[model samples]
Target: SLKGEARAGVQFVKAQMGAVSPATLLGLGVGAEGDMAERHAHHHHHHEDEDHDHDHDHDDFETFQVDLPALQDADLFLERVKQVIIDHDILRLKGFAQVGSKPMRLVIQAVGPRVDSYFDRPLADLEKGKTKLVVIGQAGLDERAIKAALQS
Candidate 1:
């Protein structure tokens, strides 16, 4: 039986696996003053689910089709993704990776513009053929720039 942190991890996996998602556990670190856990654990904080929730609440989200080069290879894809996360104030980033004979790897990362958090977990396939990434942040994160960054 799972207990303590193990139990929580299992529980989280169960809930996430049930959804059509792909991501293997990457990193999980909640800030000291941050209540990322509380917000996710309770439904009362539904607002937290949003990527952007601040005073500058002017539409702030960009989703681009994962370029062919990025999708064909995992390493290349990850490199571009990390670049985006590091270069931009990405509040949230999540995507599915499907590899033959391997469990789907879902990568969820949050760097800067808010708190730093990351989670990668293996689950069922969600993206059938194409790949996509949804990013939300403040400024310097436009679709064109993101697409260019991703293609490279």
Candidate 2:
């Protein structure tokens, strides 16, 4: 059921990308529940109140390079994604991600509080106009707003 919900959410995001070729679905694990809280809190700009390990988390992060040769609105896309992440408090996600020019969708997942797996996948593997992501997070989130943010 968790995967189902996640899949549905990812599909919704894919629709926002418009009609593109070669998309992959990835499932990323953010980490334990405690880590999720720490990450979300940090994102809120409450670094002073919380103590998180930044030295090691950076090493653990994986980069996902995407190719948007034809996609002219990259800044807008990044802004929308940032807004969605901030609004939803989503920390970990795992679903199908269609890569660029690749018909196969890889199921990627990750877990951790200090690290973000957003840039871990390769653009060559993502499907153009199809950037779909299904994220799971702790309470204090707005799923509807997140979905809307992704679309807008």
Clashes per candidate (backbone, < 3 Å)? 12, 44
Candidate 1 regions off by >4 Å?
A: 1-70, 100-105, 112-126
Model 2 residue 3 lDDT score: 52
Q: Write the per-residue lDDT of candidate 2 for residues 66-130, one digit (tens) a residue.
A: 22232234445545555555545556644444434544444444332222323344445335445
Residue 111 lDDT in model 2?
A: 37
Each candidate structure's TM-score, on Cα atoms with residue i matched to residue i, is 0.42, 0.32
Give the candidate number with the greatest lDDT: 1
Evaluate model 1: give its TM-score: 0.42
